[model samples]
Target: MSAPSPAQADTPRSTGFLLLFALANAGGVIGYLPLLSILLPARIDAIAGDARLDLFTITVIAGAAAASLSNIAFGWLSDRSGGRRRWVAFGLALTAAAYAAVALATTPVAIVLAIVAFQIAINALLAPFLAIMADEIPDSQKGVAGGLLAFAAPVASAFSAMLVLSPFTDTTRLLLIPAAAALCVLPMLRTKPRLLAIQTVEKTLSPPRELAIAWGSRLLIQISGAVLSLYSFYYFQSLGTRPDLAARVAQVLTIAYVLALPIAVLSGRVSDRIGRRKPFLLAAAFTAALGLTGMAATRDFGMAALCFGLFQIGSAVFLALHSAFATQLLPNPQHRGRDLGLLNLTNTLPSLLGPLLAWTLATPQDFGAVMLVLAALAICGGLVILFIRED
Candidate 1:
């Protein structure tokens, strides 16, 4: 592979493109976070009652499978089609329809099927949407772009809080959430980006080995994330708080990510200037592990919340920077969409693995064992990254 031309390497994207791109990604977050974090489990519990945990596990597993396949398929398809916006628009429509299905589902079976459909539709949107970042944004800007990606968490979390605190019924909340996501997505649809193309006479570097290592590391870290995303509300309730209070606690935890925004942006900028990603990645991983260890040892609500906040900050920074790092590692520019979809396996696989771990090691009343185990996995993940020699 040839090195990027001087002009390509030096040019930066406009602020307008970056902002709209960030909002588009935020739309993806808004579409799913509230559903998975708050609404899905609540709906399953309502219908499943005593078997809520079992049903929730099943739903997540099914959804994960669908997400895994759909992301790869859509990504490859987008690569073949030579465009992204149409696919994204089509995905957004499908996602909206799927959300409506979820809202109307009243039985366990119906809910699970709806969730599976939702997963497929959403991944279709996300797969190409993510590839767009790699396709358009210059490498010089990816770190800052990744930092901006952190904005999604707070935006989505705020939406979740609003849904929880609102007087609307679950059905109404379900419809409203996706509607907001669609609005966020619309602006980017109007703009087109100049796609970067890579020309190579022969491969110059070993990318597969490095990508595999990075994939494994992300999978390990994301397992902890999946567990928390699916179970944090329950974990809070297990601490003896009432349902409403637990919801508030989860929302308060959003503050961690909010604070992480500046840290991530600054770290990204520094990494861009210094051209180093591993140190920040390693530090963030260990910081998250430390927070998890703290959470495992503490039972007090206040202390636990603080520890979780710490974990959030670390994980948020790691994920944001990792995005930039991973894009730089893509082996073939032509297959970026497909390659990124492959990378997304790290995200989806955790949903399957995390649920299994939580099921085996945790109960409705206790999550300490799972936290300790997750901390260990996080440590291992950080260690794996050490083997990747930066280019």
Candidate 2:
């Protein structure tokens, strides 16, 4: 560990900053979730018809590749420039513009191009924004911060349900989602928190090895998340759900995430207090695996929904705690932005792997095989974390 830089030593603690930071995370989720999970699929189905899956796969792969590269680039750029706020604001503007382009797209090719642009813009926003947490939030508070971060999913999911259920036109909905994100983000942007007060600490585990293990664990887990996020709408349809019930499905997703909120917050707080994260992380992984396994074995819509809720609870808690754990393992404070960007690959790379897995094992009507595979991966992710000798 190293001494705090002068700027870092000047940082102040404020509940307002944490609240705004969580809201900003929700804003980021809003920026992408509704678009990727609902709107984009709907658009592709409208334009590509029976071939929507093929087009969706292509578009997602392209977007993921763009995101993978752009995240690292923007993170490094923010690090070099010694600022994250301006880059994030610029990325938000670009994201809005890209959304407009996506709305105006009339063909598959055009949609793919627009999605690639959107991915780049969104990652530019996400990479720097995440780095801000590592740069400022104290280790003692990171668990609570990660717990707060869990709020983003339900907020975004609820917004997705609203967009689907409302009588608003697709174009109007597209416009409104980004505006809602801006409202969440703007408050954080307006309030500048002072830098973090970094302190030297004895190492418990080698940072490089711990980070590598954490990265791999997250990548394995996220493959399932990426697959589910992109395919849940289709999955519900496969359960013999009426086409008009998309909003209902979105509502179910919202409820699942909402149910996970308290558990995530409570577990995170407990982990912080106990100075232990692995137990919660392990429990979350196995719980998610159980849910996915149950989902694979059942075809009943009600049962599947219940299982999905269980999975959401597990995934949410895992992500929240793992985030705090990983931040502590970051090897270099000075390069926190860039290192976190590298970690972002665990997120983006899954988009690629997930599609490949889905294309190979799943059809428009059958997702059971893919679900089982995902369950196995989640278990493996949990097992991988055991290799790390960290608290």
Q: Which numbered prediction scores highest in lDDT against the true structure?
A: 2
Clashing pairs in 2: none
Give candidates' CA RMSD values in order. Answer: 3.1, 2.9
lDDT of 2 by residue, 1-391 (tens): 1222444432445778888999999999999999999999999999999999999999999999999999999999888987688788888998898889888988999999999999998988888889888887877778888998999999999999999989999999988887898899888877664566445422322468889999999999999999989988888787885857678788888999999999998998898789888989999999999999988888888899999999999999999999989988888777878989899999999999999999999988889999999999999998898887765
CA deviation > 4 Å runs, candidate 1: 1-7, 200-206
* TM-score per model over all chains: 0.96, 0.95
lDDT of each: 0.87, 0.88
Q: How displaced is residue 142 in candidate 1, in Å?
A: 0.9
After superposition, candidate 2 runs with Cα above 4 Å error: 1-12, 198-206
> Mind giving the per-residue lDDT tens digits that candidate 1 earns over 1-391?
1122222544788889888998998899999999999888888888998899999999999999999999999999998986688889999999999999999999988999999999999998999999988777877888999999988988898888888888999999999987999999989888855665443211333468888888988988899999988998778777885747736764765677688888888888899888889999999999999989998898888888889888888888889888988887888777888999999999999999999999999998899999999999999888888898885
